[model samples]
Target: MVDENAGAIITVFVLGVVTVLHLLGAVPARLVLIFGLFAVVLLLAIGLLVLGEIRDGMRDAR
Candidate 1:
């Protein structure tokens, strides 16, 4: 279970880094802003999913 979550966390982190790089002009596109927005949404979703997992774990511990 932990290994799976770790994979997801890493993926999200990498995606965020890629997004930042693109925002900084490493990636050229006519819709840079759109890419940024998609990145933000992906990050938010990953964060929320992780948060829920953590909360569930805490509840189980209690």
Candidate 2:
């Protein structure tokens, strides 16, 4: 079973790192925002896919 909190922790870490990099001028703000948006969409898609798989597994377990 996946630990649900792990995902939230990883998501927060990634965002924090990106924000720090942007503030440090390591990356352009516009580029960071675009990449962040893309990352969020990708994460959401993966989460939905995982949820579907879990739901199917539960249904089959019965």
Candidate 3:
């Protein structure tokens, strides 16, 4: 669970930073939305992959 949630935690942190930067007028809303979606999908994929590997490793060990 920790391994799986790690990606989500990072994604949320990154999105928060991006939102702040956008609010500060450092980035456009369109760019932020697009980039945010990409980041979310990528992060989720990575998280799932890591989780799968961890599960597999544990199962193999057992």
Candidate 4:
């Protein structure tokens, strides 16, 4: 849906900004480490959400 795509775009944008900050040493090393861990969890949650949506779509198609 349009709303979902919009949310994904915002999420990607934020992740990009965080990554740039980490790369530029703008963020503290320890805090960057914590962000990295959070990024992993965030990615996994996004992946599961996408997979679930796909499965539901497929069921509807049947």
**Estimated TM-score for each candidate:** 0.54, 0.62, 0.58, 0.61
Kindly list the per-residue Cα lDDT of model 2 for residues 1-62, writing each as its tens digit.
Answer: 25544765576578778889999988788877876786687678668878998899999999
**Highest-lDDT candidate:** 3
**Residue clash pairs of candidate 1:** none
Regarding TM-score, does 2 or 3 come out ahead?
2
lDDT of 3: 0.82
lDDT of each: 0.69, 0.76, 0.82, 0.73
User: Runs in model 2 with CA error above 4 Å?
Assistant: 1-18
Give the worst 10-residue stretch by lDDT in candidate 4.
1-10
lDDT of 4 by residue, 1-62 (tens): 55656766676667677778978988767766676676667667777888999999999999
The C-alpha stretches of model 3 lying farther than 4 A from their native spots are 1-17
Model 2 lDDT at residue 34? 75
Residue 20 lDDT in candidate 1: 75
By lDDT, the better pick of 2 and 4 is 2
Each prediction's RMSD to truth: 4.4, 3.5, 3.8, 2.7
The pairs that clash in candidate 3 are: none
Error of 4 at 48 (Å): 0.3
The predicted structure with the larger TM-score, 1 or 4, is: 4
lDDT of 1 by residue, 1-62 (tens): 56656756676566666667777988655355565566667667767888898999999998
lDDT of 3 by residue, 1-62 (tens): 56647767787788888899999999889978986897779787877788898899999998
